[model samples]
Target chain A: MIRKGMIILVLVTLMAPCVFAQRVHIDIQAQSFKKFKIAMPAYTGQSDLAASLWSSCAKALRVSGVFDVLDPRGYITTAALAEIAPGTLKDWSLIGADYVVTGAASSSAGNVSMTFQVIDLSTSRKILNAQYTTQQGSAYRAVHAFVDALLESSLGIEPLFKTKIVAIREEEGRKQLYVCWPDGTGGQTIRGGGNLVLNPAWSPDGKKIAFVSYWRNNPDLYLLDVASNKVRLISGLQGINSAPSFDQTGNHIACTLSIDGRPELYLIDLATSGRVRLTDSWATDTSPSLCPGGNDLVFCSSRAGSPQIYHMEFSSKKVRRLTFEGGYNTEPACSPKGGLIAFTHLASDRQFHIALIRTDGSSMRVLPGSGRGDESPTFSPDGRLVAFASFDGDLYVSDLMGVAPVKITEGGGFQEPSWSNVMK
Target chain B: MKIGYRGFVVVLVVSVMFLVTGCAKKAVAPPEVEVTPPVVETPKVTTEMDMAEMVDPEVEARRILDQEMAEFENRDISFEFDKFNLTPEARKILAEKASFLNANPGVNILIEGHCDERGTREYNLALGDRRANSAKDYLVFLGIRPDRISTISYGKERPLDPASNEEAWAKNRRANFVILNK
Candidate 1:
């Protein structure tokens, strides 16, 4: 008999790569790692809609990078899938499946119901069971919800299925804002009334976006309310009113403005027209990203004669430099999941790469997937992946270790990608 | 030897006669050119003497004014990479621009700050603002009204040259002038 303290280091989720009882940790950044094999057959009572729902679930599992969804053709056919008997589970074990996900869909009066279960092949037991009913044509919603339930319950990190990413697409000499799912699907173009739209930053609730546009022939900051589809001018100062980011409360925005002379960081109160000057120097300060807490923020500055990332604490007004190794670094993005800052680092190849450092200014490491002009690194809300734009202007999302970056956007002219927080 | 020297003298006399006649024909052609541009047998190459010497004083003044206006707009002030301080060449251009603006008070100008595509987009925007405003401030200090000049920073968006080499980058980092109001 054994008892344990609740230090909660990690949970041994049932997902494993092979037939043996393999312990799976949730960190995809681990150097020595193998994907757990998950078998997802077509949903029973399948229609076109059911097939799509099952496909979305499978795609989410694959995008998570934690599972190797086995080919459906390799699944056993003409066999009894009724019970978790040793004989039946032996067939799955032999097929290299660690777990089998079975689901069913039924349509009623304008509603679709889905029931799914995750069965452990190695232990011969059912691990998760869930039932959901959504509007008939809205079964896609259930797909993400089910995947979220599956992962959040077992792995403690919800897979990125429902999250969205926003980027700037230059079309015919005009730059417009666009939004799509994190998988680079569902591209919806947004014309925010400008010849050039850029620096899109999503609010914490995911309902509001703060961006800068050249609509009035000047770089002015504006807020786009996703629900109303309306834009409100937040700052239209004399010089530049750009690089806006929201505090945690979503009530104020921190941005760079050159109203006086040089570029300096300023915070604007949304409710009131009141303003607070955060930084005052001859040096240029821009691209302020607030920490997960509203108290501290990091930004880019040229105080050292070249652009470098700096950390600023609001309470003490104490500022420290975050990057020292690189002569050029800018566009610091504070991780929403906490304690990490991602920015663009110019490497020896003279190409820009995404580098991550702890908020304490330690353990700075450059990521892989370095392209010629990789910039604007935004952390996924789950904090596991970062989506950045490359020299070709396509957005790519890679994990923290920067392995196997999936090209999320295509055909260039798409860049300055800002990953939205997971939709409510 | 006598025959060769005599032949040389004859050739020189014939060439001098042709040159004199040609000079007389060209000298007589200016009035006709004032009426309509004369079609010379050779390709037209206009030197400063062509405009200043042949044209009347009023027309010459208009031409000079036009040249100054074009120079005001065409002569862009460039900056060092990642720095916004005005170079001596930039200051010289701004001084000349001030002289032009003062002479033509009815004209207003817009200064557009641009940068090379080397740094992050947002930082470049800030750098561009500094470049544009620095040019504007210098012009203002040179006795130009602040309201007469408006500045905008295109950041790395509008490049005078889009190539990604040293030459293109040097051309791109500039503060360009546009005559906004005439």
Candidate 2:
């Protein structure tokens, strides 16, 4: 038995070179916002299941706005029949494909397993090879997981495909909060049966959502736990209690409260329910968005005679105005990186548009869009996309460099969209 | 002697006629003077009751309160574009309302602050709060009890007019009053 094992090991070592020679190397920097050309050849086993998984993976990558999936009709005829190893690299490179992803699936009993490899066509080197197993009906998730692995391996960034957007949808005059995948699928209503609901915000952990609803004839703040599907009222002050934003610590929430006869910013300790006033101005101050470190906050205030963005330090309570060019700049959403703020700016054309500015009050530019009421701008966790609601009540996602927005939500009456952080 | 007797009879008849006419004039003159005094005194008593019925204090208080509420509802104090400071006209209206509120100490009111649909909802909510409180502060300064007046902000959700034109926006950017109790 020892002699037989030694002979098998020698054979494996000889074959390993052939497998390594098959991979092509791909430069990581070649991947950009520009669509990367990817060729997805068919999987080896379970032809029908492999086809479906490949389609799902391609669709996910395409919807991510990162890949230009080549048409299958242009694929070399032998690309599908060829093995997933280096043998297929020649055919994919001939088609000018930058990257080639191939996989195989096998099912036994009630569980299914999938293995996929991402090959860099330029250097013939394998960049990613991952295997995942799931229940028979969860093949799509397995494929998505593989795609996420590929993205991370190539770009060194987390994939946003699995993230969800929580927004308010008004149906038949009753506003309900709904959560859906960023691609606008798998939507389910999370909260409803209120006179109106607005401003849904996601916590850093993505386990709880904070929003304002008019449940008891008054606008009250609520915290919804996504796991247990339970909601608890966070603030039900006598006056306007709305716009609850969770700080980075996840232990406190910053919200607007008018109980003192004027709407001002207040910080609520989530654990103790203790409240501390942040802004003590007779003028309007609300929509407090905490920066990444939770040490500073950017909000909209009317102290300058019109709604404009203002920055405030958490400890010293020192306030500085951040927006000046536009008189109607509001809804300040600080980026996760702590250097930029996205807001809704009312332009000279009397239309609301999405605009961005540096946190220090410099480098302001309006995102290009023709929508009249492009409002409530929220940044993606990576600060690459800005999701906002338009006049038609449709949620749109646009890049920071002002690309044409891609409409994510189909039906109307959708507003106050908040993108969740990367979910574990 | 006979001519003297005839002259005496004629003189006696003239004296008797004069005495009867004088007695009739004296009787009518006393009654005219007496009736004039009582007729003048009767209206003096009726005038007091008529004055009371015309202006009953409780009914007048309610009517005035109702009138003030109607005025408050119809005459919503408008602000300049994106402003909460009371305009001259707004202060004048608040002064008039303050007087009514002072007179009717048992009345309670609610100030509903509103804004145009131009700003963010949350910011507008704060602005509306400021607008409502501005009005309430003026009223309180004019001697109305602070507890008697409550404030609420509708933000830009509840607009007086839903149109997007300047006219509608000007009308919507206001602080309205609602009487809670009287």
Candidate 3:
């Protein structure tokens, strides 16, 4: 067995160089004060694949969270570009373009050849170039791959263009839940459109949805059967039930209930309808997240006299406080790998932002500025990103609401985003 | 002066009518009050006959609730800050209550789970369940059948005391017994 493993390792080590060469390259300055601006001219072809490619290159670059794409229509006249190339670069430079993307598409046997080039506008030199063949609808995938390579050449970090988002979509005045691919494809709804729902949570299996719904006329935690479309009330027996989470066991749920008339943490046994209370404070205890081991749970508690996250162990029933630095913290969500806990942290100004703290509660760092009320944050499956719902207005826009999240979903009004676990 | 006199006459007539009727009804109703008092007392006696009904069913419920609340007020379940397990003292109290339940099978008790208002709402709920179940399991082991006892975890919803303190939290993190449906 050791010999076989050695042989496989040897082959893998030998082939690693070739794999690295094929990977996309991203290039950003190690130190730069200004952002990179890129210009994209429409791909030329008569086929639908060409049109898809033309739209995708711009979309991919825009979604990269980098690169301000110069508007061709704003610069070059449509009538002029339709008849003549008109030297599109001249107009782009007049508006201060640092990089340019030029592409041409051709179709044969139902596959498209999307050849694209990245040029450094400053040096007037070609930075990188590539061509790909892909099916019609998936032409965007090819374009994004090329853009990824271009981004690597311009920026040091990789772009999250391919990552997807999970959101609660409001449909026809009712709240429904949905998961959309990064490019907004494969939209699937987790809850029915007509039900009143809040805070949908995804279990590690990625198959079940744990959310608060008024299906029973009062707030109750319901576990939705993703495939069978069946819904069962999980931990609900009077007084303000909400916020359910799953431990590694998958059979039990960690939820908040107000049976005692104040919100607190409770564990529910799926088999026997038994419940156990975990905290006994006169403050609110909510947002329960089970760590990777299934035995330890991290939750937000006002026990410290303010809302903060705390870690609890099952065997010893020992509780240690987790968050101490923040004035107020709530809605704790543990990452899939159990490294970080994402939560909503309130600033001294009463502004809310998504913050990440070490599981040990040592390094509590808030993500760089977002609009006010950036509450209900959750982690992506890979633990690479966090999604939260927030208002776009300045910190003072208490009057303005109902704006959709920046770029995660097509339809707006998403709050309490719970990233789904890895899908099989 | 003429209007005032007319009003005075109306008042005199109303007062006389009320006095006559009141006296006549009082004179005739001694038997009904005599007969009704014992009859009403009998049903109230039955409702209060059971230990669970020691007070007015609703009033008794409120009173029993108030009386049992002293247990939570007096006892404190200590957790580090966010934990759900019972400590040695907590177990000792649970064991004592379990013994009480074992001594009396006729009493049906609800083990109310509680939390110290400190954590996230959902996690505290699971913690509350663990705390309540920890007590329930102890009772079952003490010879109380699981069927005889039903565990209901209230999570962090209910508080024995409204004060937000270590004192209040220690009080809230408890498994309380009440004659719920019994």
Candidate 4:
């Protein structure tokens, strides 16, 4: 018994390094790693509806960058609804699949119901079984909603495929504002350059936009009525004025003004034209965004030696410092849930990259670290998608919830992206 | 040593005599000087003229201003949208202006930084300030006195071109020279 114990101890000691290395890698969760491949079979319903459902799921998964989906039609020569229930592993493997899934969609009583199952092709065993239902007109949206659930259950991060990214593009030296899918697909310019436009921002309702323009040859705030395609000069106070962001209630805008001869944040009532001064420091204060609660704002100030993000409460007019780890952190955008705030952090390399800090100002991390200059990260309504202006001066979208980032626009100098609130 | 001390005493006596002479002369000046014109002989000797006579300052200043405006119009000193950094062309033009200013004394300038009508008014004002200051720094580096130059930014609030196009934007993104005090 003594001899056997000694041999077992030696074996265990030899394997300790491998175990340590595995654990070290496991917890960080592959910062930029790809997820597993998933094969989703054609959802069975009416022929046209099944094809629609399959296409929708495929689009979501492909954009999510989480799943390498296999074509369901590529295998199972004789497929029926029953075959989707118990498919042979040999046929799935022949089609080069590691995992297989089957789903069926049906409509009854004005609601669409979908049931799906995920199976491991190697073991030929079911891993996940779930059901989703939604009203008739929202069937397409229901598929995306379902995919978010599957991704969370399997990979632990919900996907943000349905989010929209807003960017300003200058074409022929004309500044135009546009909104597009996160993947850079389906973009439409909502406003054209009859005037110089900068710093486009979305309201909490996602129905209105606020931006700065020199249409009147002075800095003025303009609110864009998205539905009517009309713009109104919301704020035209004297002196230098720009950088406008809406509060959570959509009733007021926080902006920067130099009326007192130094740039500072001012809260303006869109209805009353009544203004409240937020900061009185000598340093320039610009790039203001409401804290997730709408009661406070985070802005850039050069007062603390260099430009840094500062927080101030609206009611008490108290101030606090937010970032200390970076040389300069500016252009702050508070996340929807207020879990994290994104801002442009200047790295030692002299390149600016978008970084995240916990709303309480801890756990600072730069995205795609060590290279790539990125800035202006705006979160989606779901708080999962981060659309930022690429340092190469283009627009790119990334998922804060584990979806791989993809550059959405090319060339023409796009910057300062603000993601729209989810359409209900 | 005797000569040094005696020379000092002599210098003092002469200075005292000169002071008395100066006081007497002041009292007798004007009417007395006119009365003595017949007895006094004026010497015909060459006198030094000041260096300022070599250049007419007003004309030179106007010339320099015209040159600056021409250079700016020729795309010599232009900036990207909302940028204050001096481009190489802008630097070259500014260098020429600085040389002209250095050549002419008593010519002070205000570097006015302007931006295209794009960007927030306040941000443009700051940017304009930076642009003007950047030009001032370059001029000072080239031997213009810092006291003779000052700067201000007109962030996107003022534009040389009112129309919204590349040509207009290019024209408006500029640093202009304004003679504030000469």
Q: Best by lDDT, which number?
A: 1
lDDT for model 2, on a 0 to 1 scale? 0.78
In terms of docking quality, how is candidate 4 classified?
Answer: incorrect
Interface RMSD of structure candidate 1 (Å): 0.6
Give the per-residue lDDT of model 1 (tens digit) for A323-401.
Answer: 9977899999999878889999997777889999999899998877645568999998878889999877888887787
Instruction: Judge candidate 2 at residue B50 and give its lDDT.
Output: 58
Colliding pairs, model 2 = A22-A86, A23-A124, A23-A125, A24-A123, A24-A124, A24-A125, A25-A123, A25-A124, A25-A125
- C-alpha DockQ for predicted model 1: 0.63
Where does model 3 exceed 4 Å of error? A1-41, A46-164, A183-194, A248-251, A269-276, A392-406, B1-182
Q: What RMSD value applies to candidate 1?
A: 13.9
- Output DockQ, candidate 2: 0.45
**Stretches > 4 Å off in candidate 1:** A1-35, A39-59, A68-97, A101-117, A128-143, A370-372, B1-67
| TM-scores for every candidate against the unseen true structure | 0.78, 0.72, 0.52, 0.60
Tens-digit per-residue lDDT, A1-424, candidate 3: 2222111111001111111122224323112323468767666676465566676667656545456678777655332121123355576677788876777777777666666766676656666666766665455656756765675565544444344455566666566666654444445666462366766776667667778765654557787766566678786576557777887767788888877746778888877879999877766678788888787888887777667788888888888888776677888888776777887777655577677778888877766445545766766554544666664311110101112223444435555566665455
Off by over 4 Å in 4: A1-37, A40-59, A62-85, A89-163, A193-195, A369-371, A401-403, A410-412, B1-182
lDDT of candidate 4 over A148-167, digit per residue (tens): 65555555553453456667
* Global fold similarity of model 4 (TM-score): 0.60
Could you report the DockQ of all the candidates, in the order they appear?
Answer: 0.63, 0.45, 0.09, 0.06
What tens digits encode model 2's per-residue C-alpha lDDT throughout A1-424?
Answer: 2222111111001111112333224432231446579988777787888777777777666645556689988998544532355575788888989888777878888767777777778777877766777667556567666666666666655767557788888787778777866655446666443767878999988888898887876778888877766789999988888888888878999999988877889999999999999998857888999999878999998888788899999889999998888679989999986788999999877789999999999989888753657989888787766788887788777767655576777768788889888886
Full candidate order by TM-score, most accurate first: 1, 2, 4, 3
In candidate 3 chain A, what residue range of length 10 has the lowest lDDT sum? A9-18
